[model samples]
Target: MSSADAFQQLVEETLLANAAVVALVNNRVYEAPPPKGARVFPDVTFGPADSDDADADCIDGVEHVLQLDVWAQDYGRLSSAKRIADAIRKALHRADLALPDPYALALIEVASIRAFQDPDGLTAHAVISVRSIIETET
Candidate 1:
């Protein structure tokens, strides 16, 4: 699989397997979907990947910059979204993700996290930036 697809799969699987995250979002994590219902609040959405070649003279690998967006509807506070974001960070940061036999995920790191109030004033949004290094199978 492409690095982006692999990275996204890793994130989705990780979040699904996290009890805290599942409790927060009601298991409503998606790759790309609009906010739908109360059960979907405190959800996570995966954004596109920005990948670059990290090949060396004797090694074949790729470095990917991935984005995960956390969303929640909370007035006067962003605690819900922040909590989900924190869980995501804890689950992914410095993680050694497993990929298909065709590829190896070497590392997953949290690059940055930024939270903001959406224009609606009731939607809490947080963008988490992550870096993943993958070694391709020979």
Candidate 2:
């Protein structure tokens, strides 16, 4: 699998295996936001998938920026969304992620996090940005 794919798999697996994340989202983690008809509140979804070369003098690597959207109902504040975001941050920030062969986690850290009321008016959304540098054997 491509490094990006392997990295993403590792991320999803990590989230799924995290007790706090699983409890917060009830394991409702998805690659992307599910259709409106398939809505499940208090869920997590991937924002996008992108990668760039992170080649050093002696090592070949890839840098991936992952965005996770944590969702909850906006009853007035972002309390629920914030809790979910915290859970995810604890799960991934500086995590010891294990990628498949040819892809090893060189660095993993959580970047910015934002919580807001979505345009839909009833949804509170938290956007968490996680950056990872994956060293590769090539």
Candidate 3:
């Protein structure tokens, strides 16, 4: 399967399988449609924790960072963190995308997911983080 397609599938399956994520409380996963308007920040920078390797290149050329502005209408951080991480890990590992080393994969961070409620229903805005090395040749 294609990388994007695998990413979507991984998100769905991993979240569904999470034990902490109960069905009744937070069952559904909402995603923005294709060509999501948010700007993707490619070539994100990373540095070693304690090393001053300013010249060290942790990632190869054109590191990719895809930002999809998604709404989790029913789930909260307590139930979604593990699932989200799993989804990212699985998707990044899929053959379609460059295979990132398992050790290199890390949870960068997650922004505060605020509850967004309206007449339609309730939702939350989340900024999911993922760390990956650009294994593909430039």
What lDDT does model 1 reach? Answer: 0.84
Q: What 10-residue stretch in candidate 2 is worst by lDDT? A: 95-104
* Residues forming the 10-long window of minimal summed lDDT in candidate 1: 33-42
Writing each residue's lDDT as its tens digit, candidate 2 over 44-88 gives 888886789899999998899988888898674799999999988
Which has the greatest TM-score?
Answer: 2
Instruction: List residue ranges in candidate 2 displaced over 4 A.
Output: none
- Looking at model 2, residue 37 earns an lDDT score of 82
Compute each candidate's TM-score over C-alphas.
0.91, 0.94, 0.34
Candidate lDDT values, in order: 0.84, 0.87, 0.34
Scored against the true structure, residue 8 in model 3 reaches a CA lDDT of 43
Q: Tell how far residue 46 is off in model 2, in angstroms.
A: 0.5
lDDT of 3 at 95: 24
lDDT of 3 by residue, 1-138 (tens): 333333344444554565543332244444433254542211111111111111236533222333433344343332343344334344333323323332222222222222223344433343444322233222
Superposed on all Cα atoms, model 3 deviates from the true structure by an RMSD in Å of 10.7
User: lDDT value for candidate 3?
Assistant: 0.34
Ranking by TM-score: 2, 1, 3
